[model samples]
Target: MATLQQTEHNKTVDAKNFSRRAALGGLLFPAVGLFLGGCTRGLTTAAAPKVAIPEGRGAFALRADGTRAFRNHELVDQNGVKVRFQDDLVEGKVFGATFQYAKCEGICSDMTQQMKKSYQLMKPIMGKPVNFYMFSLAGDSPAEMKAFMQAHGIDNLPSWRFFTGSSEAIADIRWAFGFGDPNEETDKNLAGHTGMVRFCNHKLDKWAACPAQGSPESTARLVVRLFPSNERPQLAGIASKIATPSYPMKNWSPAKPLTANLASQL
Candidate 1:
């Protein structure tokens, strides 16, 4: 019943209202989408956790001077060179020692593998004349030690040396180095031996110990700690490049404390 002009005016009003509603709907939908997107993004970020930095054991500190003279025991190295403790092994240089036997099926392999990794980490500073010595606990022959070193890819490494001596000398060295009682019967089928790696800075008369059974990176850190501060930075940088292994807490106890003198430090 409305006139043509009035009808036109109503249509125009309805169209304006519809246009406003459509525009509002468009704005509302985008706002809701943006809100949802923000929430989703926040959730995703929260769910992807960052790797936590391991708790450091404080600054590198040396414990009490617990060094004992390496007795005048005769030993033959993997290279068939006869080495004496004073003239070859410690002679006012930084050195590290770990126990191994060729006949063991147990942790000897793991220890050697870790040592190889440690060597790789320390390779940059090998020129500093840092040395590593592996003492045979089972009195392995030089040929046997050479085979072990070759099998572990460390035979050709100039910085690492393998040594073996008579059973009596080996026992005396083991006792002096605090590698636990040498008389304990070990399972030949198991990797049964002291899994410790001991290192010393003869110039500083500082020494420390770490489990060789640990990750190569951790073992490398311990070895680097024995180096003088000037030589440590490079080795530490190399160690950082290696990934740390993540494993559940081990139920087993170490055969001996890493350092023979940790108690004295305390």
Candidate 2:
């Protein structure tokens, strides 16, 4: 009888050991699965596809709000030439414009520098006529604009023009461009303004804007992208060579932020 009891006790002990092992294995299996799952997620995130900005085809459309915001207002260029905004600046050419003040010590300097670089890049393959205009938010005079350009070591590129106008007319231009409050104060004791480079293929009705703080490469790319593919067959090869600019982190108040993917596409 004792021998029989011993056998039964041994069987119970064996069963208990098996149950413990099974329970440990169940816990370990889940832990292993979680670790593998985490690794897989990391890999997937690392290998995620980057967003490419479309080229070769016109992927972006001009904003109706921007087009409507423009008016046929008159302003003066750097050469002291009196010109209308619609007829002179935006009528027949590919145009790019920026809001700046000669007295501004903040982003305007960076903006002009970037513009100069973009001008250099675009001047080569621009194919057709292209123009860049800097409209003074502070109502700088032609002399003041010229002095500012000289101080910054900016050469007079054929495609670029610095412009100023009466405060009311300037305000009208500012409003039409949809830049921030023309009365807003800037860091250099200048009027408040927007820091953006607006570009458009007026003939094609395609327009877009980017932060003036962006790299010249990106800004130039944006300008180049505005050209219709069919209009500039030569651009196909040149567009492939230009590097996309990195998206700016700083926001132009009252204007939508330019995304990295969008900058890449532009």
Candidate 3:
């Protein structure tokens, strides 16, 4: 009976010890959690030191160039060469840009054909550097873009390039160039895409666009006029031969002057 009583007493003491340890552990965990929480809060609230990204290499490099609003997203060409959008492509060159997808069944082909025709027209009369960029909206791989170029029967030219990149990058370029529709839903629907060709002379700070579905001749003229007067004297002489309509033509709106500042409104 004495031994039995001693064992019971020991069991009670052990139970009390276990309860105390568990309670202490519970309190200790909260204290540790609070310390970690404080440390995390301090780290998050601290200002990150600025690091200089050489030649605009980082994620936020696009915002560094103040002259233009477009991001300098990375893009790969049909030939598998990587280039920066605003820096390598559009810096001082007069370039025309179009958005497309490799498998698009709609007006994408027509748009490309129009650009081809315009290139033929402008190449012979141009004395300045010019380029044409066909940016893919579907974010295809470089090989896929090359295959798409081949399937279209379009030969890659030194001055003309086809590009595919991340969808986010492409979206930034697309909306930046004013290719999206005013209606949000329509803009999201790739089928209802706005088939417009955007032209920019980064040096002159001039930008313009003409309907790709419209006459290629007009598109050619619109692009040629973007060049300086001395460089495109041939085009300058014939500038009076045609003009944008005083009123809206076809299903499109009339021509309006565009400036770099208007990118914010897009």
Which model scores highest in lDDT?
3
Task: Report how far residue 80 has shifted in candidate 3, in Å.
Answer: 0.9
Question: For every model shown, what is its TM-score relative to the native structure?
Answer: 0.59, 0.57, 0.61
Candidate number of the best TM-score: 3
Pairs clashing within candidate 3:
none
Tens digit of per-residue lDDT, candidate 3, span 64-112: 2222434556788887877777557755557778888888899998888
The lDDT of model 1 is 0.57
Q: Estimate every model's Cα lDDT from 0 to 1.
A: 0.57, 0.55, 0.59
Question: Candidate 2 lDDT, tens digit per residue, 1-266?
Answer: 00113343343234333342342222111110000000010012122122332221111122323221134456776667676655456544577778788888778998888777776677664324666778887778888988888877663556567888766556545434444221123212343456777666654556577887787777776776665544442433235666889986785557678999889999
What is residue 27's positional error in candidate 3, in angstroms? 62
List candidate 1 stretches off by more than 4 Å: 1-68, 182-191, 236-266
How high a TM-score does candidate 1 get? 0.59
Ranking by lDDT: 3, 1, 2
Model 1 superposed RMSD (Cα): 35.2
In angstroms, the error of model 1 at 265 is 45
Best-first order by TM-score: 3, 1, 2
